[model samples]
Target: MAIMDLSSLNNLNLDAGSIFLLAITICAFLIPVVVILPPVGLQKGDALLQTHTKAGVEGARSNLKNQFSAEEHAPADGKPPRVHSLVVYPVKSCRGIELARSRVLPSGLQFDRLFMFAQLKSPFPVAVDSTDAEKSQHKWEFVTQRQFSRLANVTVDLWLPDEMKLRKQSMRSDEAFLILRFPWKEDGWRGLFATIAAKLGRGRAAEPEIEVLLPVDFPSAAEIKEKGYTFENVKIWKETINALNMENELPDELRRYLGVSNKLALFRVDPEQLREVYRCAPSEEEAGYQPVTGFQDAYPLHLMNLSSVQKFSSEVPKDDDLKELDVLRFRPNIILSGAPAYDEETWKQIRLKPGSSSLYNDVSFHVSCRTVRCKMPNVDQESGLRHPREPDKSLRAQRAVDEGAPLMGCLGMQLTPLFDPSLGEDRAAWIAVGMTIDVEERGNHVYIKQ
Candidate 1:
């Protein structure tokens, strides 16, 4: 080794250039050391101080807190909670259409869960393709996202034709159709290339979305004989009722996309044959009025608090894939904001009052029961793909609130509208997006249905 470093140093002046060079060398040497080292108080093998700690998850356990802590129940701003948005699911298990204003009827928000999918008791070719007389003998059961997650991707839109145009075309005044769209795969090598391109985010293009028009106004059971539809008894939950089978109306392409081209078919609820809500919180017998819904699982209206969803997301592990969960995962008919997290669990009765009192009277709803959640929320509403585990896993860990079903996680609330017999069939009350939700009563909820 040659000793040349000292000789160069003797000729060099301590100028700005030298100072800058020294600073750079010092920074280069220290940066790696500072970055690689652990925090001052932390040591190797010792658990790191997590930004979102397990304390959040532990604190989220409803069992750990009071039934409804008074301090935590009310909104921080002390303002009444207002409707954030309204959603109408024209078809059960399919996507919902958000609405700014919706009419509230004795049944439900108009046209909500008015249609549903059902599969023949036997597989498609055997029962579905059989002759009309033979087809009526086979049983059909309702299907939902709980069984097929891809149903989430089936987009539904209500399309009402212009009145004048309809009159010119010689169509019925009540004629309306539901426009449905879903993703589809093309045939042959083109499909392979398209899939590759989509994955690579390149020039890959997908086939045009498969669109189908579903008749919104179906003939009643009495009129089905003349309309080429079969009025059949279909099973939804445990109740078997008459539903108008619209299998002949739907296109084969849309059915194939659902992998039920032959086996599954569409059905519309028969208003005359609708079942009454059995598992009500106040009990329909005690409430003195029986309310009915077409295809709703339990109650007429399902509500969720946005704050509760946010609070649930906060309980998710920091390293989890989902940073925050979407509110649509729960499939709420009405979303409420301006309230604290998990506040709806304590609400027993509430009134939805619009900004303009003159437009419509305040509509009251008996907060029926806690919405005992299933793994349905695990499906992404946008992608139509199911997460192996996520919000559901976290839900089970933190939000098993309803003791009625300790194993099942609970979020949101089921509601039964206090329908006025005086309004009759023609007059319907309206609820808007900005309506305030007044908590008329608060009490502990008993999960009535599984």
Candidate 2:
């Protein structure tokens, strides 16, 4: 790079104002290459973000025809697949709660993705030059592990007052609570000792774990209307939802734990509002029902086979000292076992065999599409640390099976429950561990661009 001659500006014989304008012009061209361009190349965050494109859609649909000529059915082997694990994330991107049994609802497993963390909107006006989209981004936006990997360490549990004997003495039986537990805010030498002790599984260090109790059923919609309770419009993907702000209930310790200096708040999805699934949704004639979701990234439910995860782990590069990759990293609502690896790729519908808690019909889930992967799985659930690269590299190398999202790797299947209209919304069914999973239907999945 040649150094510009400072003497040339004086030789131009221009006024001070003109000289300043000329300098600004020079900087406009040079600054992008020197400062902005290099950082954007270094960031690589946009590559991890999924974008829908016309070419991707065309490629996926064109390849779908060649993928499967006819529908495939489940094998009739003596040992059928069974539900191995059930997990639900009450808060988006936070640690999930594993259950032996959970009530299946129209939206999803009860309490799944009902709450989320978001960056609060600024009180000031938007920038004058900002576009509508940029202005919208200034409002409350959803936060996730992709931006804050430490969220993985935040453990969440749903507690009903009726279930606990001690709570009954202090509160009404109908009252419920969402128990949030996270690392205690510590710094300096004490923070080091606490982190080390926590890693070593010492009992003493566990006492510093901060617990916050949030009323799951507080500040009803009626209360919001009457008292003008605090609320904000939170943007999740392309949708903006009206959410009840619960930041007042959380302590300042949480903000420190999240490493957020700006305004951050906890929000509960409004029960009165219903957000329906858009991408790859079946027609009412085909599904006989409309599927809905809360704060979930996409569909109502997500399922991953243990065999598929095991296969994926084996293929991932083991260059790091990190532990083996498991299904937990993908955060599936249901984990199925006893099936061959990648067998779900062809599955179109799955039925939970009617057992002792059977309703009039078997509970079925329609396979929406293959879940496209991002860098989120790189975040370790237990340690809350994100690996620089490994699984994501492996995913791009081998798991880019979906032609629709050819650049993206895929692991699990997105599912929407087949709601029986006659059953009514109030009637719910229970899905327990060890329930037999029957592949009721199978076909090639078509990826509909979001």
Candidate 3:
């Protein structure tokens, strides 16, 4: 190591003022450098000062960077992966909207999974202190594409300014209102029209004419135990927590739309207060990862790999439509391209460097864990029909983690945005398409094979 020179200190007079000046100079030079270096054998007085004076700040800074920078791990892929596309499903299981760009919120993309459809009878008032799972107040079970493939046909669009103006009281913002598109009911005017047409000579009746459209708005209802905003205890999977469940014509509107007795509600993740992310790794828990999410299935973000999707498709018996499954079937917040097939499965963290777009600048995310997928992937996103086999079948043949829990056929991974240490959960840096990704950490490509 090249040593730094400290001859300038001796030029000062040997007076009281000179001595104090010498002391400050010594401290300023040694503080930054001493932390990284080892305890060395020090010669008496003058020799010790001379040795340390040669230990420069540059070496200390280099060591610090190496210890903390993204490149500390195996240097990221030479070509650096780029975001291929982005999708945000505002409502769970509903069709996802592809975006050229999107705001990266702590709970995932903005407006993603905020609203959901639930069984009508399944919703009932929950007692604040009830021990029975069903008795919990405002408890409702949500439905998804996993249960109904037609859910993919229920496309959602955001309302514009004029539309929001008409329903401002119910909708929080102009863009907040969702224009829900539903498939035509099997039994309705079209059914009668088709029945008559069959008698008139038009062969078999065409499927219900087309689709029905509805606008949904969430109006504030009575406040609950959570203090301020409308709070309800909603059960998802095995967990139930307090969330905002707005009341209005929406529940009835959705009921009529689906021809089912079900409740519909929007979840608002209050910035001041937040829902915690559970089951984090021990390291993340120690790092203070009590992150808040809105209506995401679990983690704030889901990342998919295009190569993995293609590789999986290659393994399945080819059909024209199935061949065209694309990335939408996976419903990921971010998609990465150019990485080797299934390579992302080994990543632990990624740093997203912005491309030409300024929207994605200096955003990094930590991989929470692998995404345990459901049968939702088996449903073709385009036709809103189940493929019966292939992706799910092939995945099961290769990637079942546990026969007891078949949902563990991992395809993608969940990501938690790593916020500035000072900001914590208060704010999240946004990311967008065309962003270049750098893998900052990697783990052994290990999986539980049942």
* Per-residue error (Å), model 3, residue 325: 2.7
Off by over 4 Å in 2: 1-77, 121-137, 163-172, 186-202, 205-207, 221-228, 354-361
- Clashing residue pairs in all predictions, respectively, total 1, 0, 9
What candidate 3 gets wrong by more than 4 Å, as runs, is: 1-77, 120-139, 160-175, 185-230, 246-248, 251-274, 281-289, 319-321, 401-407, 424-426, 445-450
TM-score of predicted structure 2: 0.74
Clashing pairs in 3: 3-54, 4-54, 120-261, 120-262, 125-137, 126-136, 126-137, 126-138, 127-137
Give the C-alpha lDDT of model 3. Answer: 0.61
Provide the TM-score for each candidate, comma-separated.
Answer: 0.72, 0.74, 0.64
lDDT of 1 at 396: 88
Clashes of 1: 1
Best by TM-score: 2
Better of 1 and 2 by TM-score: 2
lDDT of 1 by residue, 1-450 (tens): 868697697787878999999999998988787556522332111221111111111234322133223343346575788776778899998988777678887678988998999988753465555787775556889988777878998978676545565555665455556767777668888666545544333223443355566667756556677668887888888889898888876666666776663477789987787778776544655444667778988788899887787778777764344544778788888887768888888898898987543476788888988888888988888777777887788888888888787877889999888756566555357887678888999998878663
Worst 10 residues of 1 by lDDT: 48-57
